[model samples]
Target: MTDKYVIPREKIKQLESLLNERDIDTLLIFSREGSDPILPFLIGEDTIHLGAALFNKNGRHIMLTSKSDEKKYYESGIFSKVKTYNTSMAEVFLKELNEINPGKLALNFSLEDAIGDGLSVGLYMMLEELITKDRLQKIEVSGEEIIRELCSVKTQTEVDCLRRCIQITNDIYDEVFTKVKCGMSEKEIGDLFVEGMKKRDVINGLGKPYDYPIVCIVRAGLAHRSPGDTKTIPGDIVIMDFSVRSEGYVSDIARTAYFLKPGETEPPTDIQHAFHTAYKAITAAINEIGPGKRGYEVDAVGRKVIEDGGFPTVRHSVGHPIGRQCHDSGTALRPLKENQDNRAAERKIQLMETYAIEPTVIQDGGLPCMLVEENVVIREYGAEILSRRQEKLYLITCE
Candidate 1:
């Protein structure tokens, strides 16, 4: 089945309306080497270098690229007008801007949010020189609102792609469990997982090859390290954190396994308790997710459970939004302070938002870490777990 999730024209219209409300007469996104993740929003494809997307309040969208990139953008069929340049396109870009005659211009650079700073320091300097001091003075640059809306709200097509990715990821987890063995090395297992995913044409969902099938915490004492040559022995706790991508949509999931010898006792009581606590925390957080809920509120449910269970909370945020990138740009579900106002955070968690809530708990002894992860979508009523296989604990027995 060819995955299809094309954003409706109306969604762009909504974005235009938002720009008007913010008094953003024009939004210009410039990136060299396609380093910015936001490029996918305007170009609809990943093959672009030294390009700029101009969006006006009147809903006019134009893409400018180097002549070498003309064929790639032309094939995408997403842009209405594709401007090509053989030499320095800055002059042509400036002329285009003058024609639009926007009162204010917004660029993706923010000190507060890294997502807003897609423009590298060097690129920003180059842009300043191209526009000159006078035109630069006319432009007002800020990052708060535009980047957030572009990434947070899922377009219908994006939501569908995410949903499918979650389903495929869950299927792979089930298949991997069947091949897991106590004597296998961590690197061997990680390799097998990658091979299996490739058979399905699902590369690392997180957009980077190094992070693909990122089976960290393969054995005890290396909870957050990358998959290595560690051997899996009896009583060893195997933790796998991985995700798969489809058409740039990402789904993240993590699972743990306990290897048991022929005559070994069941998993340690403390380990089981910690695992269950982490599971409870994850489930509670998912239950609390929906429209009109703050990110911190959902995060609190998970953190409190770990704390109450006599274990230290996981160091990272409870969860993050997953999208075109593994950790998409959006509000994260973390604990809130007593004096902080979370109204804006809550507003961002609208229906169709997808998040990966991986609740982890570290035991006092620090021998092992209990981790569980699932991808879910926010609906009008509640959250839905998209990942298929929900692994509480895998018991690998050696004969």
Candidate 2:
């Protein structure tokens, strides 16, 4: 089956209803060079030309774009009307806005004006001239909440794509375990990972917006000693964090492993204990996430387990969503700490959604530090762990 979202009419109808409910006349999705993820998600194409799309409460959809992506845009069958614009997007947008002239307009600008940032200065200035000050002031409001909610619910196609990416990631880690040796430099290990990826065409997704790749390539032995010329000697604490992207859908996975000398079945005792503690935290956090739990509650649950086990809590969120982007924005498993801007901390988990069940435990006394991350999709009762959970820390023994 194709990955394209075939039935978006119903979704658009819901958006139109939302506009009417809020007295919003139009919902504007603006992008320069496809900078806005919302536009692509709503339109179902990962690539797009510089363009702006307008959706009105009357169920009309309009688009402005250059020739670069016009064919793909039309073939997708998402928009009702299309206008090609060469020089000024702001002019085209303002012209359309004037025609709609709704009581209010919704733009996806959250916090420091994300939507406006992508607009050209010429377009923005021209827009300012056409719009009435009062009308602009009263009508302009952040549509981030709406966009977030719309993007949060994963369609079955997206979930299936995620599963494929996660499987590729798991396969890569297995390759790492088999080939990695005690004396290999961290960079060598990282190179091995990159090579493994080329074998499957899983190229690194770095330097691309909303693109997430196998990150933190390799952090080993106290982390300060980054993956460079530093050779990972036996008994050194090591963690390799990586991810894979397939069709714009990304998968995230991290595994901590120990290098044991020949004839050694396991690392020394303290490292083993630390690995258990981290595993405990991982399970605790994953179990806490599901349909009804608020984002903060799940973070707190993970933090508590690590702290109760005599480890300090990490500053980052315990878990983050995986989708079009690796750190896909929306609801998240965040800390209880409140801020006016933090939305993910408050939203509840939803069924059928996927998240990375990651909880980093610090083992100060050891040489082989282990960090564990697993992927899971929220199910009816609890999370369905996607990546094979590390039941015990992996051991890469000496040759």
Candidate 3:
């Protein structure tokens, strides 16, 4: 099945409804040289380069583009009504805004969510300079909440894309884990993942290509650091967190494995304890996920499992939204710690939303670090796990 994207009409209707509820007359998704991340969601297929899509609550949706990008927009056929600008984007934007004459205009900007904050300051300054004071007053509000709501729920196509990408990631993990040995360096194993991506015609999902598939052997740190020359040894636990990008969607999964010494049938005691605790944490988190549940509530349930199991409480949240970007914006499953913004986690989880539930445990005194990340989509009843569930720690017996 193909993973090409097409924004469904229902999403447009949903956005319009949100705008109406907020008394927003129009939402301007503006970008320069196709720099804004929100542009792709409004204009389907990730093809449009430079343009502005004005979604008005009155069902009068229109797109504006420079003459250079006009052809690209038209060719995609995603937007039916397209307007063109001759030279100055700022001047043309003002003209179009004047014509639309919305009483309350919303721009894509946010202080909390990075993905929703795609409109750069430079662009905002240019827009501010061109528009009249009266017009500027109408543009007071940020459309970030609307954008987040629009992106949080996955359409069938988006869910399918994520599923396919996740399957490929799982297959690559299966292939690479089978070849891991007790003497191989962490970098060597990471290179195998790189090779797997190349063979599959996919790219790394989250950060710099080399930094991902985080290979943490034994007591190494659990940050997004690059793989190092630390060699795997017998009785050592290795944790790998990795993701792949395909069709503008990404998949995130982390697995833990233990290299057993000669004649050892399973992982050591401490390793087993940590792994099982993490597994139960993730399972509890998944069970807690459902429509109408709060994100922090879900996080708390998983967090309780780790603490009850006598492991160190993880510094990071239980999980994050995963979509076009690995850490996709909206409704994060995290705790409302002291002095932190709690708005994202406070939002109620909705059906069809996807998240990566990672219940991690980090220890200092000889016990292994464990991060168990699994992708799931919220259904009517509960969250459905997308990846092949890792019920136990993987055992690597090869010398």
Candidate 4:
């Protein structure tokens, strides 16, 4: 547990405003403790969802939970009401819902939206049964939109948390490069990073920002290699994707380290070119950042950097906003992809939004994928880099 911080009041107010604008009475969510970003974010403390929590348009909040958790929920100070389910969970939820009797409710009902955004189907089904067909008709699958908007931008408190995490991350990398040698295994290097954070109580998000999937990798070698027991060669590259959170705010950044053979100080010609290209893409993307720039346009700026440089672009978004979790949900700057509904990138970037501008480049003939990631916040006039930008590959030279 970290120092107690105020519940993100501004963010909650923003959600309340959205409710008034959309004519929805409440935003209902269902998730266990620490699993849902919105819950911990608005509550400002780790919250346990015994069943569901409801946020009214007036900014009042109530959590429906079992009697076991009722006491704990009240202590959180985030929710104005803590109602416990006495009978079945559904009965308890129905009683609480009746108390509020919101005219219209916004929920993440669609299968994809629920899966992507997380929803408690048990509570959702309970509401369906109690609200009757007419009342259920008023429920809309706009919770994802509400969730997206509420989490898209960072508050001053949230930003401060991220800055702290980034500082810790940079310092860890500084220690890592000095101690890491050519013979170290990728897994070993990654374990060092993990241990460093663990010692400090900094928790890494095992999954993407929104819990889409958990990919914990410490990539080594220039050949799309996942961190394995394989010993690192003299010329092997180190590109690790790590997301660690401090006080529930996550910092997502990656650095490319270079390990040259004995007496070799300089990186290979091709590797240097590719590394610089990746850095250039990140810079170009930052240059394109500002209030009102669409996520896609910003993404194109970075994508063009690699493509014009005769390299293939990354498969995912160039950069996405980070907070509370890795790949944290909010806004995004992603390429326009066919078939999938990628709406975040189409919207305009806003001020106070912190994002990870990571552009990966793959050289012709499939050299190791060159990746450079930095956490940045978009300001009114420009953007500010939260994480130290990887200007040069981290070099481990045995001179």
TM-score-better candidate, 1 vs 3: 3
> Clashes in candidate 3: how many?
0
TM-score of 2: 0.85
lDDT of 2 at 195: 76
> What lDDT does each candidate get?
0.74, 0.70, 0.82, 0.72
Q: Which regions in candidate 2 have their CA more than 4 angstroms from the true location?
A: 1-23, 44-50, 66-70, 84-99, 112-124, 205-226, 338-342, 365-368
By lDDT, the better pick of 2 and 4 is: 4
Q: For residues 38-60, could you state the per-residue lDDT of candidate 2 as single tens digits? A: 66567775445567778888987
Q: TM-score for each prediction?
A: 0.86, 0.85, 0.93, 0.85
User: Where does candidate 1 stray beyond 4 Å?
Assistant: 1-14, 45-50, 66-68, 71-80, 84-86, 129-131, 206-219, 261-268, 336-348, 364-368, 389-391
Q: Any idea what lDDT model 1 has?
A: 0.74
Error of 4 at 96 (Å): 6.2
Candidates arranged by lDDT, highest first:
3, 1, 4, 2
Which regions of candidate 3 are displaced past 4 Å? Answer: 1-5, 8-13, 45-50, 89-95, 209-212
Ten contiguous residues minimizing lDDT sum, candidate 1: 1-10
> The CA-based lDDT of model 3 is what?
0.82
Candidate 1 Cα deviation (angstroms), residue 357 = 0.7
lDDT of each residue in 1-399, candidate 4, tens digit only:
344536355667777888899888988877665555456666655545455778888868888777777776676666788877666677767777787787778775443332236655665565677667667786555577677666766777778878999898888777777778766666777767776776777666654332211112224234433457766667667676777767777788788777777878888888898898898999999989889999899988999988888787677788887876676666578877799777767788888888889888754433756777898888888799899888888887643
TM value for model 4: 0.85
Candidate 1 vs 4: which has more lDDT: 1
